[model samples]
Target chain A: MMTLSSLPAVSQAQAPGLPGRAGLGLKHEHFIEVLETSPDIGFFEVHAENYMVAGGPFHHYLGLIREQYPLSLHGVGLSIGGEGRLDRAHLARLSTLIERYQPHSFSEHLAWSSHGPVFLNDLLPLAYDSATLQRVCEHIDQVQSTLKRPMLLENPSTYLQFQRSTLDETDFISEIIRRTGCGLLLDVNNVYVSCINHQRDPQSYLDALPLHAVSEIHLAGFAEDTDSLGDRLLIDDHGAPIDNAVWQLYEKVLAQVGPVPTLIERDNQLPAFSVLLAEAQQAERYLAQVSP
Target chain B: MSLQDDFAAALLAPEQACPDGLFSINGADPASRFAVYRNNVHSSLINALAAAYPVTLQLVGEAFFRAMASLYVQAHPPTSPVMSEYGGALAEFIQGFEPAQSVPYLADIARLERLRVRAYHAADCQALDQQAVLLALQGQADLGTLRLQLQPSLATLNSPYAVVAVWAVHQTEGGLATLNPWHPQGALVLRQGLEVKVFAIDPGSVAFINSLAHGNALGTAVEHALEASTEFDLHQCLTLLISHNTLTHLHLEQKVSP
Candidate 1:
């Protein structure tokens, strides 16, 4: 079991989270529990937006606790793959947060959340056409230039397919990386979830991805239910413990992708810190066995 | 419309249904696939709002927050991908909002919560010391015509309700539902080190801070403080602001000679 005391010493100037270990998304409910008990998770991940408030207890705890653990600012907003021009105010806010925490790795979804004045809070799907691809790449370029750091773009979990999408999802991601030199935050659960939703093979989806471009792997629990047609449906709920299928998927990906930073994401119904640490330890075990 | 834009519109406003080309199922209706994106958009947004205003959720309960968030999502959806900055205007909406009228303090809570969010994401700056500020103001004897600077992370809000106590209670371990209407309170929100904190300010501190926030200099702020209460201690307010890192940059508004 990797312990906090034994983990790499995190410097104020260093990127958050020690390399080649598994982490858990730190929810507000588990703040003191994780801090007081000091769980042996590899590191902790937080939504960049959660701590984006001014002087409050959230920052108070994060500031103190972040001193001991490597932290990553996983952003769900900043829709990097959106069609509209990047919101400067949002970028400025994100810049302030990045400077304050100096997280290990900054990441956002490869989907748009905004349309003009209305922001659809979900990671809405984007067409995988060449024109859309160029727009996303340009947006990523703008973000990287402004932040002066490469941001990892996570593959989104999709429910619907677009007719105008001229490019495959894998090819779109590959082209994005080739153009912008950005890293990939590949969520394995998302692959399985999307695969089941789209009636595709998860293995084929994962195999098609540019594994070398991946800087991180995300594993989380999904709620399994049956569609009206009795087909298996997987919803990436992140509210439960890691499911066996997702774990097995993680192991398979680990075997191929080798050791990358893996995060166990549990956003809702967050359990005790030990519960997440145990989950992280499970991923750590897989990371150790991977051919790093 | 571009495919992405069409998809975005369809997801946000399910009434603006997608054409059959977006997804073609062999045996299913189009709404089945559209429902997935629709559900995703609603649930994800509800979750985001819950995360943003946990206290508000706690105040109204999950079911109510979800219903309210769903309505909020329809009326005012997120304009930015950054979820933290998404619900800044929620408090304002809750003010004119009818369903939440019984909980009059809810809007103030949302306002305070938004302030807390803004302070956390505000720019980073080093606070100036009292000595420097005092020296800067040494030559200016005109007390009423002075202006001062507040920190980027500092936000001040006044409320007839005991919003500070209300926020404080929800923050504490056993204080979730303990609401006391007797004590009127105000809040001074700021980020200290890496954390955002909210301090309950008395009437004098509120007046002094508001004056400074209005670009009034130290002398004018002190004057405002004195008018509120003869016992208003400017030094105490100054010390508190300095200690909390509420003042980051110092500036003087040029005096307009009459």
Candidate 2:
């Protein structure tokens, strides 16, 4: 029964926070290339669950790569918005990973992915109400306390809204941050996708969030589809290049947040490492324009 | 049911109506929008399965695999958040699955792939050096009473089908055309220097390794191997294990001197 308290304290000094430059999501295909070339990207982000295995090439490469660059661990399966109590075993595994890698930042979605023993792989949406808000805040608190560090909660790119919802998504996110004292990951692509899907202004949606608390930003691509009424529905597929509109939204975010650590996220249809590097460099150009 | 309870249920069951209280702003049907979540859940899980059992995917082709995997996902969603650990029951599911029965060896292939996945992520342990192993062998102790500890990543599979040959052919371009996949086979799967390698072994070696894995003494394991196959060669098995760096430690069981 290895509990968080039972685990030995991390003896090494904590790694520095993510630099205010562009980073790319670390992929398996690029592990050897990254080690061989040692690109000048700001940091490498990995889905925490991908490296949650006991031992393997994922750990081997991550250990070597972590020595060179700061790391950001993004979790896709924490179920932060689930109605049930948080999963202790999953939290313990996360604690172990954080101690082993000493990632500069840790983040999970504001959506839930598991229900009871069943873990749905996608980040599912939640109803934005007081009850949902309270549960999300408690989950965030539990995660933060268990990991002994603040975690960023990324806003989800949801397809539909709940009719029972009584609060705006931004208000709900703001309330959670206010209560749990957690930072915002500020996924600009999600804001654009969600706002467009719901027929809301993306800029106003961004303005509603607590931008001062944003520690990182994620920029990714989306797939467009139409709903029953022929309204444009944007899906955050992360399979294509970052959309021009999304990149424009990112520029707006950079102007406001002033060079927060940003990531060019491509989970599917991953191109060559050089292609992703080019996207990160594009973000670097935007980051450079932001005043200190 | 609660929102999540209903939501999770509907996500897996397309026949079920969309969960209540979900709406689209432009007065569009919620079911269509809800379909996105359902699609994401199924496709992402199917993709995870495809990634895990790539040879299984290639053998059955994408359409059939996705159809079969969708049923498996609905029946048994992952219990753990770790995606790599998901689909452990797929082999068992494929055994009972009627459509996959056309490919009689698919289940065994699934089993081998699962072992490879497990071996890839199993805990790391340093292999005993050649010098240490040689010293243990030459020590003035009865080799019969000595037990061998194997690496955590080591695993053995005795199958009724030529799983190793089938799996090996899929790794390359076109060896499957002239190969026989019906003969019984044994496989040894272990990670060597971060790469997981699968080797075809004799029935004797499979029994020997399984016995050792079950904590039997060297003498007892040899007996088991000989019982499984008359052609069991102790020296050959020892050489293979040693060369592959499978043995991690050797322990001697002390006997009272009479």
Candidate 3:
């Protein structure tokens, strides 16, 4: 057997150009397809926790892809909204992964997914109050200190609204970014979905957003459903094609926000890679016009 | 003020549930709205568990797995936000679960599956060579007390059922033959490159590796192996371990005569 230690250290140096382009989430079924063809997309993103293990097919494919393209480590389990101290072991695992992969960007959700020892496994909303805002700011501070890098916190697609919310969603996000010096992962699809679900206007909400802090953009599909009391609701399913309305919103967002590093996310009901490539091509066309 | 804390409290206290009175014009009821969040949480977690314990889920069909997973979640909703690390205590839970008691091997299967998951996520390290290991072992005059360091991803599990056969069949994507539970089997779990691999180990190798893992030196571990089986082959066992990357580190200390 070849001596692995004798070989030169794997050049984990980041690829020069990754930012300001459209990317896609690399899934299992697409790994072989991606490896063979090497799609012309900007970059790829993976859930850090998904690859948090020692050896698995995930790492194998990721390692292969890492050599070719820039990657971002998007975390869904950090639970930045929790009240207690951050989970050190979880942070350590993430640190080790970062040390190995050296991703271009690392991010997590602004919403909480865990409370005490009970993790809901869903990005549940938090009431926009001073206490909760302060808690979230402190958690972001800890995460930045631990990782020694600024992380973009994505806004969640909320289903329910709280009556006692003293602060607006954009304001809360702005406050967190201002206090912690972290960046924002503006999910335009989420903005449209949450605005409809909460019965708010998307443009006004966008107007209030801290556009300068925005580092990345996420565009995904949304699902509309009715509640028990006969009300219309929009859910961020990310399971279908990007709705035409959302695409139009993305156009509006691009016109204002300039060309951010946008991602086309599809978690369920994955289609052919070409189908995704086609969507990305359309995004590229839109980005092409505005980038200059 | 903590939305997560308040929402979590409401989810737990389902009996006293009061709708938040928030409604959209398209007939999306508040109760229905709440249910969507609840379903997403439960289904995602259940699916995550199923992914981690494929063998356990296979033994008990999806229906049973979902039911058991529901109970497991309520009993121990994940402490960490990482769902991959959620089912750490599933083996113990299976041992005591009344409905699954008939299977008997289910708990062991859970143990093996959990080990596989752990081995996958374990920290990456270089395995030591045979020459280095031998030199380290030779330093110890008394082998009984010398504790050998097991690979961080290594795990040993024994089962009354044909766990290796069961796990093997389930891992394959094609049609699989049904497994019989009568024959006893022992398995050693470890990661090779980017995949966690499982292999069957003889009774002697199992005892010897277990002893070495508990910090016994080669001489004493060999004695334990011989006690388990007179025809024990320590050389072959050590070679197997070195080849498989199960023996990552070695430590030698003074042995105590019993």
Compared with the true structure, the alpha-carbon lDDT of candidate 2 equals 0.90
Restricting to chain A, the TM-score for each candidate equals 0.91, 0.94, 0.92
What's each prediction's TM-score? 0.77, 0.96, 0.85
Model 1 alpha-carbon drift over 4 Å, by segment: A1-18, A26-73, A87-108, A137-152, A175-183, A225-230, B14-20, B24-26, B51-62, B103-105, B116-156, B160-205, B222-258
Could you give candidate 1's per-residue lDDT for residues A28-95 as a string of tens digits? 77778877888776678888877766545677778877898887888877877777788888888789
- For each candidate, report its DockQ versus the true two-chain complex: 0.33, 0.82, 0.39
lDDT of 3 at A60: 78
Please rank every candidate by TM-score, starting with the best.
2, 3, 1
Give candidate 3 regions above 4 Å deviation.
A1-18, A28-36, A54-64, A88-100, A178-180, A270-274, B1-3, B12-29, B128-150, B172-179, B249-258
TM-score of 3: 0.85
For model 3, how does the per-residue alpha-carbon lDDT over A68-158 read when each residue is reduced to its tens digit?
9878889988888876677788889899888888888888997877778777778877778898899899888888788877788898888
lDDT of 3 by residue, B126-149 (tens): 777767777766786665555666
Native contact fraction (fnat) of model 2: 0.90
**A-chain TM-score, model 2:** 0.94
Which candidate comes out best when scored by TM-score? Answer: 2
Predicted chain A of model 1: TM-score relative to the true chain A?
A: 0.91
Cα interface RMSD of each candidate: 3.6, 0.7, 2.9
